[model samples]
Target: QIRASVSDKDLDMYEKWNQDYGSWDIIEKKKKRVLIGAASVGIHHAIFSPSGDKVVTMFKDNEIAVWSFETFYCLYKISIDVGIEAFPSDQESIDVDITLPISQSKFQLMQQPLCFSSDGTLLVIVSIVDSSLFVWKWNEQSLHQQIDIPLFKEANGFNTPIKQAKFIGNTKLIGIVSSIGLFIIVDAETGKLVYKMPKTVLFDFVEFSKDGKFLSGVPSEDPKTIKLMNLKDFIKKKLLNYLRNFGEFPEKYRILIWRFLLRLPENRQPFQSLCDKGLHPAFEKINRKYPIKSYQMIKTLERVLSCLGHWSPLFAECDYFPSFVFPFIYAWPILQTFFASHFSSDEWAVLMDHIISEDPSFIYYLTVAYIRYHRETFLNMKTIQEFNKFHEQSIPTNVKMLLKSAKKIQTSTPTEIDIPKDIIEPFKPIPRSPSAYPLFSNYPVKIVHFQKKVRDKIRREELDFLQRKKVLHELSQLHQDIETDERKWIDYDNKVSTMMDEFWDKLIKDENDHQEKVSKINALETEQRTKLLKNIQKVRQNLVHQSDAFLNKQKDWEFKLDTARASLRETKIVGHEELQKLIDEENEILK
Candidate 1:
């Protein structure tokens, strides 16, 4: 049998009926019960629990009753107070046979006010009047949580009202859609917003899949088109967008973000193997060079450096090797607050790869920017010693500014330079000595001088490119302005013609009584057209003059760019084969 509830014409009486499932025949009719005394009072809506074991009915007067399905008895009753009056005291006991009346309505509802969780153990009620949410442990007849939804100021400077809300599957989370189509998910336990989607379109309806893996909505503008989204992918995209826009991570998530960005595998076995091998023989000079007070810190640094050396001999050959390990050690103490384990050798190796694999042109641009930033001070220095001292002091004081300026220079220019592809070759391990001792006290100075010469050439080329690029951009803008002006003139002429046609039609309709008025209108139209033509002519003349000037400037810049390109092709940085020969000569000298 199937059970159904019905209301009379006046809505003051209610009845429950039992009917045969397939035949549509009423098997039994329960007694008619007077639900409310006032004819204006009525039952608003009713819904069954998922199991159909219980029924919850809301009345027009802000009173709700929960009833048992088997006995048809009223189990509990509660009244919602929307700032009108205090809540009515609960009844100690209620007779199963009797029906009670409720007070008159106090506040209007925006939508269905309440919903049940999947298990029916909890209920969520949206209070439209106060903009609040109340979760109830309905089985226990007690309030579980109350959350006040604040109005966001950025939502068009008004309080976006909640249109509908429901529990997401069986989880302790609630998904809400506002009237303006802003969707948000909130953690029911913590009362914190976990995800929010901006209001880009108005939705007529929204629903989550049973498992809460997907959400589907019908846009109000196009009811036939349904928008379905995978919740997991949507959240990931939102996270990436936030990172791109804000470029900062919260302290708790920093390590995880760094690991993700660096693509760290965190392979434990290989890292452990390197650690077990102890310090490398090449770093035996660390005690003499950078003596430390903390024995544990020194030991940790040695272990980390040895792992790097085994991974790549190039790292062990660098003059300032300790500088790399010092940062990781300092970060280790802070990272310990979030993670229990110490930094691994695998992470260090990955960090080194990123630092060393950058394109050589990036470094050249950085050095060039650094020099130009202190160009005046260098030009003023008379002696080489003075220049060297100034260079050493300026680096420490202006390091941050120099980096910012270098990034600006790199990004602002077009990347069209034609350089040899072999410039970005991978690092090759140097042949080890028989004693496995460190090779040199400092890096080779000749290589540094060679790098400086290449940087100076690249800098001149970049300056020439920038000048040509600026002129080309200006020419493009000028062409667009001319087209825009012509479009505007055409639109103005069409508008004037339309107005004149409408005015002429009106005069024709009232011709007999307005002969003099038609003459005056014609004269006024003629004057307006003449003035418009003069303005159009003046604009055309100005545009023609501007075009002529820009064309000449464009030609000049193109010639300069051609000359720069020719010069770049003629100039030669050492070829790869020559560079290899130089490296071999240096190695033979060391041997």
Candidate 2:
């Protein structure tokens, strides 16, 4: 379920844009105003710079324009060969989820909009008609969000136009990564294909699951299937259900069963062979002798084990190593399922010992995964020799015993399979060693200060908010006073007009009588006008003084910004000088 929606979809436009807002270029936010240049036909994308100060637009004419709105300036321009359909990459860019269906032939690539990541890390240009896709990377110096047009094939349900775009952080971005009916999810922040998921429409949109475990979409193959997951979720959910027959075993007791199921590779030859042999007829004899109906369990195991046999055929090392590494890298419950079955304490110890000794790489991450995934187990076994032996370079006797058990794990088929020999040669012998490998934290407290600067800006905005409110209040009061003054002047003008009309009407009837009074009235009016002019001048002078005070405050703020830049320059100079001195010392030491 979508938890939130994007705000501010309408880009600010002026004048002629009252109708053709789409024609405006990328709108950039600087302070209060929005800056935009022509985007050829319409503004397909609008992006704020990393600082949210400048904006760049990709135009339909294949021209890129830059704008700084706070200054009301068009700063720079770069030309592109591709048309105006560029994608915006700011973190706040819209996250679209599309499960809607559209015709593949109608999907035009030339008009499909491009996408960039929210943090300004990657740029993407999508073409629905040509079925071409491009991915550009950010590498600091040149080509910030460059595009590499991807070649794609045209087909029916297989290939369709892409319609949406999104980022899964920096390394992996999902959604419509390509045309030809594909919702590509490359590696997180990087361009590595984890799995290709299905989409509903030719332009079906894809997004990351909140937890980042699965990539789900409104399905193409099945309309009702809005959620699709990897083999892992499939198994987990299958185990989760209260089924007709999980073959036997309570839901609570099925964890170890699932773990064992995961350990069984995509292709299970042993299971297939068992189903072919039909449950070891020996189990039937044992059931008759013991009255335990263990044959039923054997049959269930046979079918489950046989299920993997028909899966994709596996080649040698190259094909399967990545598969093996994935489970270990991501600790799928390999041990949990194995132990879920009723097992003796000796058996449990033996399994643990074997995993640590023979599967050192697996064991290292297992213990780490345990600490990560199974917090309780990690806390309880925190001091266990098995987990700590990597640093100690010593294995306990129990570890050796477990290795023996793993080695002895066998099938009824015939030949003894050596676990070490079966595994790839490179991983056959992971040495026991004591070494201090530097540990790297997932999220470093020290970022490059870019994000920190954004936070500081937010804080500054909060501080300025009250100041802005005060300024607004002052302006409102000024506007109300000006309106009141206009009303008083209008009333005074009306009274003078009434008096003049009465005098004009009286003059026609009695010109002689009115001459003396009119002269005296005119003189008095002249004096009153002089006094009113003087008072108006004084009020204007007071307004001017207040205006100067407001302007002075603004100038002071600008000056502070200027001084801050100077201080920044001074700090950089000192740091540079120190670096130079250190270099000189190092040179002398080398001599």
Candidate 3:
């Protein structure tokens, strides 16, 4: 029989299947599964376990069921308890008409919220609505850990909905990405967030390689290109960015940051185990060697020193270990006391009398600057005794100038005087025998190492200070030159402005004179045209009178010609009889 199942166009399983006579048949006769008691109505998603022996189904009613694939029977059921309180209050006030469809689509396009580890030992689930994460031990079917996304308090309690989560290779660590681009790694067992990233625009999906060496994701801002980050490099760059952005951790966060830098685990059980071991033998001389007025402070110091001694054998051998840890306990009193095994109480008092600012933090800077001031003299001394002797002799002479320079250095910008790495890291003294340097065997090796570090730091600071001074001097000179040039440019600009004003005034006058001449020429031309038109009209009238008189004269001549013709015809008719009379008449006409 073939096993088959049917789903709607959206691939949401609505029916179960059963084998029937070499073919699969719908168990509910094409009807949707009915909700009965606590039973789930329909399967929204399903996935098979790595061993293919079991399957997990996410149902329509915020529930998941584990089923034996071969037996086809429900094994366990889990209800996803993402209550309304898990969602941000602001989300509820959002206009449904504006954001309903968009929010719905985001959920629809999101990946499956549940995943199994590579070995199938642990199962991880995330809620689409609130981004609440849950880790479960698959075999025991028990919840291991649960936490909200973006656990860092710095996230300011904002809801960053998780987009995808998966196990990193075969490790017990789970990596998750949020819609707002918060990438975090959490320990599956403890549920502690191990790594957190600053917010960025992240695409809908992110994944780790099979070996979990690299994590790759598409950025929403640059969707066409995929970014790959090496796990080690990503963490290193993140730490560097943190330090660069916030130059110094606040006072409250100092200890936590120190623990992080030192890679100290926060597990309480281990620290308690060390504390239970009692005080180290080396610190038995605490009451005699470094007398403290407060009994509680002494007890605290002993307990802490004992823990350190128990953690490392080297700490047990170092006689000056208590002094090294003293400042962290009673900060101000420790600064006032000089327990270096060399300086007398009288000499320390004399040095303190000259100093004005007794602030512990400033004194620390002052001590560093003091060591720097006496660097050359200390270097010339071949033995620790000679060094201590010089330190005593030099204190009274230059105490005032040293305090002034120390205050200046203390107030200097962080960039101008870097807080050295050696200063930030906890001091670890090298193991050395008393016979190695017999001249100063009473001096703790810790102080010698500290002096060397101070000298090195002072050398670097001196060079930096000189370079900065030179730059400032150059900048001052350049500023003066720029001022001089600006003055000359202002004068030149004023002169040019005056010249341009005169030129414009002359040009305006010339244009006015030229326009006046053109106006006069136009007026004269108009007058000439009027006179010429009048003369032409007078000539035309005389021509018309002459032509009329000539026409009348021509008409009279034609009439005279016609009468002469008629007289000639009459004379020819009576030619013979009247010949004599005509001859006389002709003679009269001729006369």
Best by lDDT: 1
The digit string of per-residue lDDT tens for model 2 on 70-148 reads: 4434454432233233234431221221111122332232333545565666555454444444555432312333322
Instruction: Supply every candidate's count of residue pairs whose N, Cα or C atoms clash at under 3 angstroms.
Output: 0, 32, 0
lDDT of 2 at 570: 100
- Evaluated at residue 235, the lDDT of candidate 2 is 35
lDDT at residue 77 of model 3 (Cα atoms) = 61
TM-score of each: 0.37, 0.31, 0.35
List, residue by residue over 1-591, the lDDT tens digit for candidate 1: 122432222122132222111111123433433332213434454556555655576655666776554444566665544312222333312232233455664323545567777777777777655566777776666777777777433445455567778777666678887666767787676687767876665676788888676889888778899999876556555555655464334445456444533434455666777777887866755766556777887777888888877765556655566664565564432121111122243333332222333344555555567578878877888999996555344133244455467657767756465232235443333332333333432345566546545655676687689889989999999999999999999999999999999999887877855877878889999999999999999999999999999999999999999999877765544465678899999999999
Ranking by lDDT: 1, 3, 2
Ten residues in sequence with the least summed lDDT for candidate 1: 17-26
Decreasing TM-score order of the candidates: 1, 3, 2
Specify the poorest-scoring 10-residue window by lDDT in model 2: 309-318
Q: Clashes in model 3: which pairs?
A: none
Model 2 ranges with Cα > 4 A deviation: 1-40, 78-112, 127-133, 136-141, 144-151, 155-161, 177-180, 188-190, 198-203, 209-216, 221-591
lDDT of 3 by residue, 390-506 (tens): 634424335446656776876683854546422443333322232221122334567655754575477578768979999999999999999999999999999999999999999
Which residue runs of candidate 1 sit more than 4 Å off their true CA positions?
1-41, 50-52, 79-111, 152-160, 241-591
Local error of candidate 3 at residue 201 (angstroms): 11
